[model samples]
Target: MHMISALLFGAPDAHGSRRRADLVQDLLWAHSDPEDAVQHIRVRPHPVGLEAVLLLGGRADGAATAVVALLGRSAAPLSRQGYTALPPGAPVQPPVPSGPGD
Candidate 1:
């Protein structure tokens, strides 16, 4: 499913990449406003390590960059149809079943 959010995350150590998503979320929430609920979170990957993509309840225009700065890590944007995030070792699920053709 497509998500509306700012994808800004950093690399993780090879040993614990699977759990990095939760860690990134914690850091974001810790620095973000209490009301800006994180609607979506995807644990993807990076050349260096794992990363996270977050769709907040409110506008996430600058949140990604901010997080990058706050965390002192590099950041990148998630395009509408470009980069994708898939958890390591996760099985590729089949696409959602569509309705019968007319």
Candidate 2:
């Protein structure tokens, strides 16, 4: 099994963050595969709004796909209610060495 993490922002307050976290948990429970794909979930306050993390169990790609779908499905309504998702940063690549052969 693999683990995937998601972060959500823009909750008005701690209560709002907790509520949104609960909604996310419910959605995952109802929609994810095996009915237990969500292994763990958490929410904490952030300066901009709130932060949430979800640990999912499954193949990495599949888990990512599920999260994408879940976010897509919730984005509109959530945005209308003032919640936003924190986009992930691009993966860093190692620098390649270029030198004359000895």
Candidate 3:
């Protein structure tokens, strides 16, 4: 159960960037898996009106896949936040095996 967390900061354009980011964040949270995948996510406006913060937590691999899916479905370009890879400080959890215990 690898875990990853990311913080996406919006660009300088207040209206477009903030709106797009908010929409993306909402969609991401809506589609997130609270049990096996993303446990939680937080989105808020930044001090700079043009910027925002997106905090997300989920399985590392799953998070990566979700991010890709989100980007693929998005009308706006998420590249402005330099989202080429996962953010720092993401924790990886050990996998849980399934089996019948004696």
Candidate 4:
């Protein structure tokens, strides 16, 4: 079970992003392999639209295909602009530096 990551763009707003995430999860649950896809998801604000990070369970190509198909049928304004297979334990995002005041 390899780990795959993807970024989905084009969400109207924060609320819309949340809705999109929920819809994605539901769709994946219904459409994808029961135990080999869509492990986790996170949403963040972006200039064009909200960006979502999807952690999937499979090879890069397979994961991308599943996500693309799911997004195509989702009916939400979301598109997978980028995705990659991650090495085990690789950090999805860079670590944030703490301020001195903290």
Give the best candidate by TM-score: 2
List the global CA lDDT of all models.
0.44, 0.57, 0.44, 0.49
Top-lDDT structure, candidate number: 2
TM-score of each: 0.38, 0.56, 0.35, 0.45
Q: In candidate 2, residue 71 scores what lDDT?
A: 65
Error of 3 at 78 (Å): 4.5
lDDT of 3 by residue, 1-82 (tens): 3334444443335556656556556755654444434444444444322222233355455656654454344324444443
Q: Model 1, stretches more than 4 Å misplaced? A: 1-12, 35-37, 58-102
Q: After superposition, how far is residue 41 of candidate 2 from its true place, in Å?
A: 2.6
Residues 52-83, model 2: lDDT tens digits: 56677867666666666666666765566566
Range of the 10 consecutive residues with the lowest summed lDDT in candidate 4: 79-88
Candidate 3 vs candidate 4: the lDDT winner is 4
TM-score of candidate 4 on Cα atoms, chains taken together:
0.45
RMSD (Cα, Å) of model 2: 11.1
Compared with the true structure, what per-residue lDDT tens digits does model 1 show for residues 1-102? 223333332343577655565555555455444444545655554554445565555455544444344333221222122333333223544224368992
Q: For candidate 2, give the lDDT of residue 46.
A: 56
How would you encode candidate 4's per-residue C-alpha lDDT over 1-102 as one tens digit per residue?
434444443424555655655655555455445544777655554444444466787677677666565545543323342222222234455334469997
